[model samples]
Target: MAFDSQWGLSATGFYVPSYEEVLDSIQDDFIARFGSDIVLTSNSNFGIITRMMARREKASWEEQQLTYYSAFISTAIGTSLDYIGGNLGLKRKVDEPAFATITIATEGEYLIQAGEQFATESGYVFTLLKDVVTTQNNDGSWSGMGMVQCEETGADTNVPINSITTEVDPDENILSVTNFEKAGGGQDYEDDETYRERLRMENEARPGSTAAGIRSALMNLPGVREVNIVQNPSNATDKYGNPPYSVHIYCLGGDKGSIAETIADYIAAGITLVGSQQLKVKDATGNKLDINFDFATNKPVFAKVVINTDDAWNVDNGAEDVKQSIADYINELEMGDPVYITRLYPAIYDIEGVTDASIAIGTSTTTLQEKNMIQTDFEAVTCDPDDIEVVVNGL
Candidate 1:
């Protein structure tokens, strides 16, 4: 017979005293109680002891009922929530290394076996995860692609296989080793803010909520930056198999095996459909429903920023930094988010450059064509360092 609109929401009523205020209040109280018996002298041991005691008092109060939410609160709240999630089997994921394929050209017949190692210009060592047979091409030359895994984890390892430090074969002196495509999936450990958001959702998510559970499951995998799930979203054949009632998940920055395993676990019920959208795998007598797992489709966008050369071009006027900053900002954007062409200007100005800048999504042309926004509806958008071009006054 009663109705409450905001039942779940909690109204916070708390205040944290500032450091200075705490000291002043402590001094005021001490003086009031002592009535001029104590002198306000910083040089005195009493003063030092008084301030330390006051700060300790404030610290105890703050720790007990922390109203302010900073990293301190992140650690505080996170510690409890961390335990709660642990009980629920939702542990925070660790960092993961990136993977890439390097095309190694050999002069003579060479077997680029797995475990073979090479270092980049940045001193990052990568190992061949799979063997590549350097067979003769039509020209009778030897070249093969080797799947390489970065030895280190973190975004810094996501480099453009710059150069080959050690030659695969000293005799043939391998023609050259280069990565046409950039390595990806490398990411740092989840920060407090991101981890907090994920923790917020775990408690409220409904059971069998495909969107919530699947996204959480995929995100739990290390290096997975983002995830998007579409369930029989459109009449058109979807990216995953186009089966009716089927869910297609596009994930960014995750290991292939982990992503695949998460998908399998999500659909483990023998009744789980393999390819069909509407029917469960065990329940369906028709074709099997498909559970697909793959990296988020990367829509690479290039930027050409036009800036004053004479005034702006200098050592601090780092064009490279601008490019990397812009690409990092763009890559961090959510999947399916559109890229605003003009938005790249801030990225340019953020650099230590002298002045003004203009941006073009794919071309350096000053004329504004339809290059305003890069449409991403079903895929994640990424910006590699190679895709950005920073020009100094068009010269």
Candidate 2:
């Protein structure tokens, strides 16, 4: 009877979809775009979890975008969860990327000396070739004066050579090799060969034959770490081309300022013997004479100084100390640091007491201490009452 009453009302039934059908509808679309290797699940939530797990596994194995994105999302979720659970990871990574630095070191005085030597050599060579004087008379006769000019027998070019086997003697006025050569060329052909040989012999007898001697002289100076020298034959047409030379000095590690100053001082003290013009020999009564002399001058020569650190950026823990020492050295030498140089890192790092909590707590403590000191009797002096009372009683 009751079943008949229930049947009189509207009939109702439950509809349950198949797991395979639902999974095929949703997961098939996902797999078409993503891949067929993806796993299908009965539950939507379970399908999502499976997809995430698959992506994470793939990402872990093959550093692909899908895997990377999944891992990043997982990490974000995991980190959030861990933070909520109060489990922070070990240490935060420093933001600075890795890099390397270079530094140079040299002495200023050494650089100056090298430069001066270069200049002196340049001048000597220039003067030797350029300062020639020729006198032409009305009879169409040409006479050359100054250093002796010798004619090359084979080359037909004028060569200058000193005649004296020793230094130029004050009493003797022997013809210059250049003059002898020219005279011999005009007088007899046999004399030309003799003069040419004499010029070659004189050149061979020069004090320093090779550029190595000049480089050695530079190296002998203080604070010179490395030295390089170069020499080339000057063009015969150019004034200084007759005897050309070049020098370069490389100082690896030293006080550049001090070195530069020392070089300048040495130059000022006239340690280098340079050419200058002087009056010819004269009698006691001051009679005019035909001789000329090479003298020394006090004029300061031009030089260039370059100072640098050997390796600036690779200092150890003691870098600051070393850098300070370098700075002090520079100051002592009276030179400023180069503009390109800068502090690679902070002079000091607060690693001793730096913690997330300590920093916050220390800030609060400092504020409180500062506030309390504002109204304190900082200027008031206190006397002991017992000591005062004893003093009064004794009085």
Candidate 3:
């Protein structure tokens, strides 16, 4: 009886049902009566129901049409979010922007020879030669003075005025001077203390000074944007409160591999360390550039890593796979022993598709519903190269 009332509609004389009738039909409908409004409603009611049904059907059809669409979208978004969550990846993308910062760590001894002494109004000239020597043009009033000088020492008073001299041998005490002045003719114009101090200052200011040498050495490498010398106060002071000297280099441009190689070559060429140690370049997040040098042995060690991943349709799944692959690859790398995970990232892609089929009496053919799942690739990496091992286990 309830089904009869729910399925049956009171005949409204106007050919189609009213808004009220449709509502009543939905509330009362039992099975077959549910769709009765398709034929019973007035034009306006019929049109409204038809449009609403069409939209609802479209959404439902879309869901069934593609199995992987949602999966792919979700994976991409989720993986990217995870990557950004790590600080190193964020800073690298933001601060480094277009270039990568690389650090070269090395240690070696330099062979230096102190040059001839000369007299000038400002002071005495004592030229020091080291490595394959090349001289730069002298600017200002001090120009064309082949040698740098300091105040004459008493020991040099009896020596010949124009005598050209050469200094001590190679690999000697690091802090000792290679040459010294014997007693000379003029009023002991150069004081050894004053001479040494002036030379220190001049070498620091000269373009061929230790700082300049390091800069020049690095600039010779390809893609080096610029170089800066920074002093580290923490290590700058000695136990006796004397000022310790150090060189901090700022390097930009080039990928990690090229930069590391250039640095190794420079170390092998004999750049001396001002103090007992040196500092390397680091990112904003304090991630150190890949570089190593053995000062004791005068040998430089370098590490290089390359990562590649398969295409991924899902971010979460793809990132996992990439993380695992990177870990596995790193384990197989010989040079990557000192390497640690530094950062990870997710690259995402979007895909879409649809299918429709129909049949008519004239065609006399049956239509089958069609559906498919789209495919895509996702990529990600671990921060520490060594962490790749851990990622493999987790993946």
Candidate 4:
């Protein structure tokens, strides 16, 4: 019987004939065909020439060619796959900055001119875009002219306020201002592979897309990470100003104000607003602001992990790893998603010493629903290292 296919251990990989073996075979063939008198040994000139020919054949065919073939399959294939995805439209998401309004209080009726700068104690600079002049109304109540649009200088503009604190300007006449609301819109630039995936989503969109279409578009914006577009959420209250046939978008990432305004504007452009269905809003001072919606507070939840390990071990170190694993799992949870206590079990069991784990999360010993129609870029429910408790049982 003869073998038509290439001989190999497995797949296309094959073992090549060595130079010494081929040389010996060639000598045996020559001796068998010629007579026993024609002896081809190592000292013979013909034997030397045969060995040299064998070496050349082995170097070219077995060493060089086979090595190249193996590498071409193992290494370049990954790059080729990436090239294919690039052709299919995959790209990374970019970063965005946060915006805030800082009030510049005056000792007297001072005019906080536009472009006036205020700095936090830690030197976070906030600047005003337009002049905010002090004004008195007929009702003896004052409004506007105090709040100023402020952006962080340079790259680091994102910061959260413990409470609404008034910041003091570097110079006099400017009191303290704190960004009561959490600052958002800070994100790292997406890498090549991540960008590619985003592009694929857009390419796959149809002429008339579904909720995923809106999500894809919103995710493309800088600083947006997670998006959940629930259409006609009539089962719940008409919260977040969502009317019948309306969509309740729960976004995680980006500046709350920016994302809120962007969502309202995008919908308003394509749809008509009539009757009492107005998107217009006014501030306390009767300044007509665009749209009607607001960001909600981040709901806090706690997690306790009880693991039954076979024996006692370095639980303190193990606990840190367990906490990080749980945090990563929670971070990936979608906006408005109910907390799954069982989800933490897998994360805790992944730790080396944990044989089994019983995890409890939130205030009660059950799954908790997410609130806040719009969770800003940094407002997702997170478990601080302190928030997670890890106990090893069966010691």
The best candidate by TM-score is 1
For model 2, the run of ten residues with the poorest summed lDDT: 386-395
lDDT of 4 by residue, 1-395 (tens): 11123422336555566666667666666677777686567778777766777677666555444444433313222344345445644334445445565543445455666776555555555666677765555665433333333354322455566333534445555444455555566666665445545655666762123567656766766666676654553554354445665555655556655554455534433332222212454434555545432333355556777777765455558878888898777755655555566556677777787777776677433552232223443245645566777776777
For candidate 2, lDDT tens digit of each residue in 1-395?
A: 00122222134421222333333444556777778776566356648754555445433333333333333213223333223223222111111111111111121111111111101111211112223333444665443333222212211121122221121221122222122211111111222223233223333432132444333332333322233322233433224222333222232222233223322322212122212222233334554333211211111111111122233323342333433433332222211112112221122112121111100101122331111111111111111111110000110
Top candidate, metric lDDT: 1
Model 3, TM vs. native: 0.18
At residue 54, give the lDDT of candidate 4: 68
What tens digits encode model 1's per-residue C-alpha lDDT throughout 41-139? 777766886788767877765664543332232343656646655766776655767787788888877877788877786677788898887877899
- The lDDT-based order of candidates, best leading, equals 1, 4, 3, 2
Give the alpha carbon lDDT tens digit for every residue of 1-395 in model 3: 11223322245311223334444444344225555454534366555564455455444444433332323222223333333223212111111111111111112233223442223222343333222222233331111112233334322222222333322232322322222222111222322332333334333443233556545554333333334444434645644333454333444322334444444444322332342223364534555544532111111111222233233233355434443544443323221122232311221111111011111111011321122111111111112222222111111
Candidate 4's C-alpha runs over 4 A off are 1-91, 94-96, 111-172, 188-200, 206-210, 230-248, 256-297, 306-316, 356-358, 363-380, 391-395
- Candidate with more favorable, higher TM-score: 2 or 3: 3
Q: What is the lDDT of residue 11 in candidate 2?
A: 41
lDDT of 4 at 165: 50
